[model samples]
Target: MLFQNVIKHCRHYTAPVSAICKPSDVFTNLSNEFPYYLPKIIKTSLTKKKYEDNIEIKERIKNLSEYHTLAREPIQGKLTFLAFDALAESKDLTEEKLHQVQVLAWAVELVQSYFIIGDDMEDNSETRCGKPTWHLLPDVGLLAINDASMLRSFIYEMLKNNFDQNTSTKVENYVNEAFLTINIGQYMDIMMSKSKDFNKFTVEQYNFLNDHKSSFYTVKLPILLALELCNKVSQDSYENVNKICTDLGILLQMQNDVMDYIDRDSAPVKTSSDIQKKKCSWPAVTALQHFNEEQRREFMNCYGRWESEKVERVRELYKEINLPHLYRLEEQRINKTVLEKIKKLPDNATPSADFFYKIFDFIHQYTEDISPSILKSNVSMSAI
Candidate 1:
C-alpha cells in the first residue's frame, strides 16, 4: 500500500508546483506531481523485499525522504542559483528561471537523500542530518534500502520531465559516473577503516579518498548541472571545474575531520562519526603520520573499537598530537591553492573568482570549526 493513493491522496499531493517552486520551499514540489511527473515502477523495492499495509508503516517509509528533506542544506541546491543569478547578478532574482531551478534542485535533493540514507545504513550510523537515521525507525530496518532506492527513482523521473534530451543525457551520464566513483570512495572508506593497520595508512591514500569521496558529487556534479542549466558547459570549463572541485573537496574533508575534533565540545551539531567509524580522514592519517612506530602500533590496536575506553584513548591521542595545530597549517595551504585554482577559471565561469572567495568565507563561518580553544591560540587564521 506504499503507493496507494500517493497521487490521488489530496493531503500528500495537493501543493501545486507553483506553490513549492521556490528554493525556499523545502518539499520541492514532488508532492504535487512536479512537472507532471509520476513514478512508473509499480513494484518498488520498498515492496520487493517486503510490503506492509499498515498506514503508519507507509507513513514511516514516506518520512525516509521527508526527514532528509526537512534537514536539507543548500550546499547543492544553492548551485541552482547560478541559473537565476546568471539572468541577473546585479538584479534581484525574479521568476526568471525559478521553475526550472526548483525542479532540478529537487532532483539534487532526492539524489542526496538516497546517498545519505544508504550511508547511514552502511555506517550503522545512529543519526543523519541531526535526526535519527531512517533505517533505525520502528519496523523500518533493512527496508530503508528500498526507501533509498525509491528516492533515487524520483530523480530520474523528475529529470525526464523537466530537462531537454541533450541536457538530461549529459546529466544522467555525470550522475552515473558519480555513483560509481562515489561508491568506490565509500568502499575504500569502509575497507580502510576496517583494516586499521598502520602500514595501510598513507597521505596518498587520503588524497585519493578526497578526490572521489568528498568532491566529485558534492562540488563537480552540482557545478556541472548548474553549468548545463546556464548553457556554459564546455570541455575546457569542465577541466577547470574538476580541478577546482578536487582542491576544494580535499579542504572540505579536512574541515570535516578537524571540525569534528575541534568542535566536539561546543558546536551544537558537532559529530564524531569519523572517529567512531574509524574512517581514513585527514586527522586520522595525519595523526598516524606523526606517530612513531610504537605509537602507530599502539593506536592501531584500539583505534576502530567502539568501546568507551578505546574511543577515549583515540581522543586523548589526537590532543596529545596537537591535531588542531596541524589542521590550521594545512587549512591555510589548501585554501590558498583553492583560491589560486578559482582565479584560473577562464574568467567566464559563473560568479567569478571573487565570488568563490566569498563562498570560501561563508563555508568557514557556516562550519564554525573556529570554536576550538586551540584554534584561537598563537596562530592567526585571518589569512585563510
Candidate 2:
C-alpha cells in the first residue's frame, strides 16, 4: 500500500511528461521522487497519537517514516516510519510550520539514511538495527552507494515540490551548504582515525569536527530550514541561532562519545569503530587535554589500536580521568546556554524557539544517561 501510494504520486507527475521525459528518465526521476511519498505514508500509518496543533506537521512527519524501511535490510514497509515519527513529534507542529516541519523531517531521515548506508559500507558493518545493513544485503553492497546518492537527491526533490521556485533555490543553497559542511566533518573524522599524529588534535578540533559533522544536519540545518521556510531569517537571528545550534551539536556529539565509553549494549557499531579508526571523539580528546604526561602516554598506546585489552584500558582511563563527569558538566552548560538563547527570541519568532526546544528535549532524553544504540531508534520508539 505504501509503495502503491508513492507510485500513484509518481504517476501524477510522470504521466504528463511521458511524451517528453524518456522512459528511463521518467523511471529514474520518479524513483527519486517516490521515496518522499513513502515517508508521508509511513508516518500516517504508524502514528496514532493526537496533537493539539499543526495537524499538517503530523502529515509531514508521516512522510518521513519511509527512511527506516529504506535503511533496513529486509526493508519491511511497516517499520519504516516508526523511527522518524518520534522525531517529527519532538518538534511541536503547527499549520504555518507544516511545510518546514515536513521538509526538515524528511531531510533528517534522508541525511540519516545516506550516512548509515555509506557508514555501513565504510565500516564494513554487517548488520544494523538488529537486521542486515544496506551494504550487507546480497547484491546490495556497492549499490548502497547509489542508493545513498538517491536518498540525497530526494531531499532536493521534496524541497522543490513543496516550495515555490524562489524558496526552493534558497532551500537548495541551504542543503548544499550543510552537505558540504558534513562532508568536511566526515573527512575529518576519517582522517583523524588514520593520522599517526593523534596528539596534534585538540579539544577545539574535536568541537570543530562535531559541529560541522553532527551539528550541521542535526541542529543547525533543521532550525535554519524551518526559519528560512517561514521567511524568518535575519542577520542577528541567523548569527545567534547558528552559534546556539553549533554548540548544541558539539555537546550532543560529546554525549555520544561519552556514551561510547559507558553504554555497551545500545551502541550499534563496534566499540572499536572509534578506537580502531583512531577517531578523535570527545572523550579521547578530553582525556588528552586533562591527563598528565604518563596518563597521556597510556591513552595514546591504548587508543589507535584494535586490541581488546587496549580498548578496556582506554575505557578505564576515561573513568579514571572523570571524562564522563566532564561530559555531563559541558552538556549542562551548553543546554543552559541554548535555553537562554531560545528565551531571548522575539515573540514573533516563537516557532523557532518551540521547534528548537522540542529537539533539545528529545536529545536530552536519549543522550543523558544511556547511549542510544542507534540514532534511528530514538525516532522509532517515539513515533507519535
Give the candidate number with the greatest lDDT: 1
* Alpha-carbon runs more than 4 Å astray in model 1: 1-62, 82-96, 263-273, 345-352, 355-362, 367-384
lDDT of 2 by residue, 256-343 (tens): 6665566556634332256666778887787887888888889888887778898888888888888767876676666666666665
Cα-based TM-score, every candidate: 0.74, 0.70
Cα lDDT listed for each candidate: 0.59, 0.57
lDDT of 2: 0.57
Residue 379, model 1: Cα distance from true site in angstroms: 24
Candidate 1: lDDT of 173?
81
Model 2 misplaced stretches (Cα beyond 4 Å)? 1-100, 266-272, 340-362, 371-384
TM-score of 2: 0.70
